[model samples]
Target: MPRHFRALAVQPKWHAHDFTSAAAFKAWMRSQLEMARPHLTTNQPNLVVLTELNGLPLVLRGGRWATPLGTFQRVAAALFVGRLARTLPLMWREGVSPIRALQLADADANTRLYLHTCRDLAREYGVYLCCGSAPTPRYSLVGGQPRRAPGTLTNQTVILDPQGQLIGVADKVYLTPDEEAGGVDLTPGDLSELRVFPTPVGDLGVAISLDAFRPEVIGRLEEQGCTVLLQPDANGAPWTAKEGLPPDPANLRDQPVAWLESSWTASTRGRSIRYAVNPMVVGNLLDLTFDGQSAITGRAEDAPEPRSYALTSPRPGFLALTPWVTTGTPEHLRRAGRERAAGSGHPLENEYRTDVIWADLTLPATALTPPARTAHEEALSAILGGQASRNPSRVAPGLLAGLGILAYLSWRGLRKR
Candidate 1:
């Protein structure tokens, strides 16, 4: 079997109630897997990547806690500054405190279910898989259960092997301003410590969503002999809009920004970047819509432009990328990680469902295309995780705006209630 093989991106139409029961969740996943199973060829190591926090709905099955009460509270809090004054009494009489609702939902059972589901999928499909990302507690696997060390939960990515072995977990290092206030109440990962796991496909590294935006995180991973960047994302917004709160969740169409950014980013960051899987969270949960523009992106050294391909449906669909290794000996490929971007060539195959989109992205991986680093580049990369935006001067200003937004959201009204 050739070392290079096909990779499947699983995009599911996840509902708020799917996580209520493990059986239901697994059933949903199985259906999607069955759809993609037809494309999985034999004698090749198959890789499956999902979006970020795709399993979070399991914990959200908790009653009113899963309601838009969180969103209501957030916006109301933001506007009123500490006075749910009118809303509090209304909620009190209605009988469910948004605060209590938020507390009631826990990832304990959800986490276990998530692990079991991914393991089963890997074992069943006989393919390597990333259970996508989840907002799991700051945890360590002691024995078999995931245990936290008394810190805020971290947005996590669980990597699994074809044999169903647990490889490594990558955490979301950078949280958006909105994430800080509401969302998962996530605690960012230590930027200095990155997780790159050894996979059947060379050394595999994962950057959950925004982590790819910084040059530092992906830069260091590339520096560490890591290839096959598995990015499980949950960016809930239209493609064209660069930044800010997303619009209404009712729109049934998806934009192309997810793949667009990743494509250009791969060119700038030096690697074939892929997996901008829209954290497709669909349902009646706080005005958030994770549309299905899940994409597979990469760049070929010979090609003038980077490749960006994704689904257009807002429902369920996926992008298939057939990985191509350089026409060289095993030893050459092994050391390729240190010298150049892993899988520097083009994608041999790019296929998808929904609309049945297909493309040929094959390129020979021969030379090193790693960009030279400068003093300012080094310092900035260290600060930011990946290259999200090209404007270096805007970095400090972006940080300031984020800080200001965070401070505004931290107002008393938005706090917990």
Candidate 2:
């Protein structure tokens, strides 16, 4: 019997400085742990996948006026080093005891440092760590720079066993201009190379967030003997009438499920998430945006509902999953059958097959202590927090002065209505 495992998707609020100043980032990360600890201590999900940090870091190289608008590109470079120093320890201390396997969305030069640290942390926790690097610049010529495409970009999902030795890697095979831009040229990985990582849980496969959106990608993974597909991404943008969602879109719809050409993940036969819709981000409340319902869909034993978890869900939904390595003709036969059946099930893959055992993953909700806001963050958070916080007094003064007023006068009704 396949054991049920509790799994949680965490998208921590991160800024440029977080990784640059490991101490500060660690402290902030520790505080956020309070929000997740209850879930881990209670639900004990066997897997935890953390979202990559997305905010632009402060300027790193050029003069402020000459530099780009996003963030210090260098900060992305520093991320791995910071993770090694601070974040990885937290994983070992908290997640390691309960969460047996962990994954993350990797970005930037710091990714190198982060991977090395993850290797070390895997040892400390006696757990496995898997992370994927972002695609390089997407455009053939980015920011007026050009380079040859590398067969594989740095930071493919580098897998480390409990002893922290490198095992397998899944380089991304698809590329968009954005992924190709900003720095080095990226080479998409071979699609045929996608395979499962034998894990303590089961034969596991991971498709980075956007990777999951491509039915072909997930199909290939499933075809290659993968049982569980873990997709980690950073999503949550303004909704459009054209966008169609509320995510659980069982009834309402332009389409029951949201589909975007640029979505982070898609699968051939099982479930696909339009976006990570957890409300962990501060602006999410006002914008009504969310990322990290980290929604999952697959059939396991016909439960009343396909398994799903909110970041705030109760714990113990996951159990300690031990994947005993098994290799046999039976495994091969199963894989072949799945592969043959894959694309028929969807357009993305030609043929793919796999097995999955499901169980409830209940994670207890913990009190969320919002991370302390720094002065620099006030601007970003204000937009997310709500429009109500905008200075009403300032608006009132301007209104009283009739500043920059544009009014229409009607014959009978000239009111501000």
Candidate 3:
């Protein structure tokens, strides 16, 4: 039987450097959970969501900036450099790697603060909490449990149950250019490492910001029976217009807000999968404008109402989704079947005039009949990919002839010597 419950996506405005004090950071963290608590009120277990790197902002806040930026130009310069070049020498003196610098000072303590705070929220609310992503060097969760690393680091997302037990972890598979500049070197987590976290709502999977852009990652999770793709994101300047470009659309490179949402919608299309809840970061970090388009999308033609819903603002609040389990409509089913029959569902929207998405969703059974690949198709792909093996009988004569020539050359050379 299909299970049902409430799922909340919180897209709060991140105040950079507001939590410079450890005490203040922890207090602010609890308040953020308090903002999300009311939305999760339910007898059934709920799944609470937050954006990627949500905790890292606090970590960064705790660390003092060596160079202060007073003007917009200075901020822009800081964003490009990511301030790592100036800080690397200082970090080395502390006996730590450049990669560890990204998580800032007192890395382990700050990380524990973030984790413990969220765990408390989960236990308090009795909700399954899929906490935000963060870059940490000293700590990691591997194989659904804590894996303490003295040096290694990854951009990881952690999920906890109502009782505050660890459910799963998803490390990012890709990193942005900005992260690389910030000395955030991460080992990408593979498909096998990305496990599905079973919750009261459904089977949950996570794809951190950059991972969400990789379609193959999502497809692999779907193949492994994921019902909802929890996308924790912290994006910078993808929505801003190109400053020096020509007025003509062709001459300039800039995408409209709708265009960005459309691209994200395409990611959830045709898979017959249920929902995609994306909670994104917002506010200015250095000069980086974290775009605040947190959205929740569903399978094509599945929900009768708006399957694609988004929140544009970063105000402290919650966007809740109550999942109503049922079979797809005939029209929706026809489109899905056509996609299955054609061996591909053509990738195929939402509330008007609002940044936040608050709505009910129509979903189906967690398990569905996915389009299976035929042997002939698989063989063709293998052949095209140069993976097909050559026949042993065809190569034996050539191998023997080559060996014979080699032996003859050695014999002649030895005789001449």
TM per candidate comes to 0.61, 0.46, 0.63
Tens digits of per-residue lDDT for model 2 on 1-417?
333454444445443334333344334444443344445423323444444322112111112232223333223322322223332343344432100101121222233334444454555545444433333211123343322222223224544565656545555665433334322234555677666655543455656545655668767765555555665454343111123322233444221124322222232234422112111221121112222223333323222332222111122212221111222354453343233231223332221111122234322232222223322123222222222222111101122122112111110121112
Please write out the lDDT profile of model 3 over residues 148-223, one tens digit for every residue.
Answer: 4544556778777877766666777766655543334455555656656555666777888766656677777766
For this target, which candidate reaches the highest TM-score against the unseen true structure? 3
Error of 1 at 304 (Å): 7.4
lDDT of 1 by residue, 1-417 (tens): 224556666555555556545567788767766756876768656777776777655544323233444453454333222223322332345342333223223334455556667777788999887778776655544554334444355677877777666666667887765556454456688776675555554356677777766667777777665546777766554222334322323443324433444423543346443222223322223444443344454443323343333321122222333221232443443333223221223332111112111122222332333333323223222222222222211001122445335434444434554
Q: Is candidate 1 or candidate 2 better by TM-score?
A: 1
Q: Candidate 1: lDDT of 399?
A: 29
Alpha-carbon lDDT of model 3: 0.52
Candidate 3 residues lying further than 4 Å off, grouped into runs, are: 61-99, 102-105, 138-147, 181-183, 238-272, 300-417
Query: Where is model 2 more than 4 Å wrong at Cα?
Result: 1-4, 22-37, 41-45, 52-109, 132-155, 182-186, 239-256, 259-268, 271-292, 300-303, 306-417
**Ranking, lDDT, top scorer first:** 3, 1, 2
Q: How well does candidate 1 match the true structure in TM-score terms? A: 0.61
